[model samples]
Target: MINPFAPIGRGVLGVLAEIGRFTAFAARAAASCFAPPVFAGQLLRQCMAIGYYSLPVIGLTAVFIGAALALNIYVGGARFNAESFVPNIVVLGITRELGPVLAGLMLAGRVSAGIAAEIGTMRVTEQLDAMTTLSTDPFKFLIAPRVMAATITLPLLVVVADIIGVMGGYLVAVNSLDFNGATYLRNTFDFLENQDVILGLVKAAVFGFIIAAMGAYQGYNSSGGALGVGRATTNAVVGSIVLILALNYLITAFFVE
Candidate 1:
């Protein structure tokens, strides 16, 4: 007789196994970051690719998010004659929460998927195997640099996003909301604290590690061929976004309390 609980057991076991594999992969990647024979060139390239190339989308997303956030806050505040708090709330939301979370989500879609596809293709084509035969550690040569670069660059991106996001709120507040430009700027500046910025950057760094690790892990384990690579790319993005949201809450809770 077929056991009714067998399917549930299998699903739970599969999830546990996947979690174990991912944990081990992340540990190895973390260890590889400090190992010798650093790939300076690859690291630099990845920094440029992950950081510089990511600015346009990050900027646009921040600006739009800030603008929309300002508008919503203003409308909500107007209901209770609290409209003057727009600048304060906008700045706080951008730096403390929205900026890092949005940036991480955007990067998970862009960087994680790209990494998976690039590495997955390489895997399917046996390039990783070739590197192995040539005495090159794929972890050192490929994964480590990408992982380290992502970790290093994301905080910088969050800083820029925070600035642009505040600027976005500033523009809307001045042009449409008819607030005194100087007062709006002053409110924003005064309300923003170093702690908020630091918190966001800390979140960004953790999100970065998750993004790169998920991508490389999915790509490295991918089999089959083109179809499999495509599937891995999808999984990388999905996994990164899930982890990003979950960790954001945990980090915020830890620091906020």
Candidate 2:
């Protein structure tokens, strides 16, 4: 007789095993972060790579998203004669939800993949082994800096995203939707609260940590050769995105409910 549940059981076990391994990796990285002869230069470089260089893409994305969101909300609100609520709703949506989530997803695709590819290539070339021989701790020198950089910089990125997104919505509303610029701006500020922005920033920080950690974890474990590096890159992006989305919901619920 075929054991129908065997595959399901195996899948569950595999997932659990991966989770366990990732948790252990994260713990080790965290320990190294605190015990480090801190690499300030590397951390600064990573911050620029992960945060500064990402601004253009993140800004472009935010602008388009905000514009599209305003258009959609305006169209929907027209049906109920609630068009006056557009500015308030757009700002609220951007700050409380869309800003952080979109920024995280973007970084997962860009930064996470890059980290994985770089580290995976090093691993394949036995560079990490050489580091060990040179008495340089890979976790402290490589992983900790990237992880700390992401965690610290993500919130800043999200803040910029929020501002740009709000501005995009304002532009759309005032220009395309026949809204008074002053009135729209006033409504946006009036309706937005500090807590809403705070929640999004918090989510950004968490998502940043997840992106870098997943990338480092996948790359550090990868073997084989080019194929392995490619696989690690894919896994890092996929894992970071999935975890970001899942955790976003949990954080939102915690804050809102």
Candidate 3:
């Protein structure tokens, strides 16, 4: 009774099972996002919790990153008497790449973990089910608002991070490294194009959506108990980070021309 088709059947079933689950969840979340008794208060709270609360961490990270980037660029560009390009490169790199990527990764670690743990706990305690029994659309009331808030707020955070990061670089260039402030700002503005800034903002928006969606998806689907919740939290952070990197490349490619 050794069946050669058994392995193939099992593999096929596994793929189908995952696809079905993913599709069902996506459909439900999407439907709830639009067909909602809009939870404005919940959404605002989430925006503040996920967005405003993250500013300190993002700002600190951006400052250090910008300073280091300036130093590196200065050193590298100095090698060939290309020191004049330092401000331009630093600004472009921080605004167009580092700002969005770092902000996204930071949020992924902070916000995603919180969302996953909170939602996973609600699920484990059967609170989500209780809401369901009460004729409440759990997806609309919880997941959609959080996701929408994150998608809207994360870009604003990145924008702020970009400004702070550039200022950090400017400080290094002006005070620590002894350069003219006026000259540095002039070079930064002159070298930076509108497209560069736009590209970064676009990247930020995509990263925001990815972070929220991944967190919501993993948390909403988590099962088991404490262990499952922990796993989902871990997955949310890891998944969001990976997706941020992958999407960055794709977006870069699109704008490369």
Residue 121's lDDT within candidate 2 is 95
Off by over 4 Å in 2: none
Model 1 is weakest, by summed lDDT over 10 consecutive residues, at 185-194
Q: Pick the lDDT winner.
A: 1
157-247: candidate 3 lDDT, tens digit per residue:
9888888998999999998788899999999889989888889889987787777777878888899999999999998898789879999
- Model 3 stretches astray by more than 4 angstroms: 1-28
Cα TM-score per model: 0.98, 0.98, 0.90
Rank all candidate structures by their lDDT, best first, as comma-separated numbers: 1, 2, 3
Each model's C-alpha lDDT? Answer: 0.95, 0.94, 0.87
Candidate 2: residue 24 lDDT (0-100): 93
Candidate with the larger TM-score of 2 and 3: 2
Model with the higher lDDT, candidate 1 or 3: 1
Which regions of candidate 1 deviate over 4 angstroms?
none
The TM-score between candidate 2 and the true structure equals: 0.98
Q: Which residue pairs in candidate 2 collide?
A: none
Report how far off residue 206 is in candidate 1 (Å).
0.4
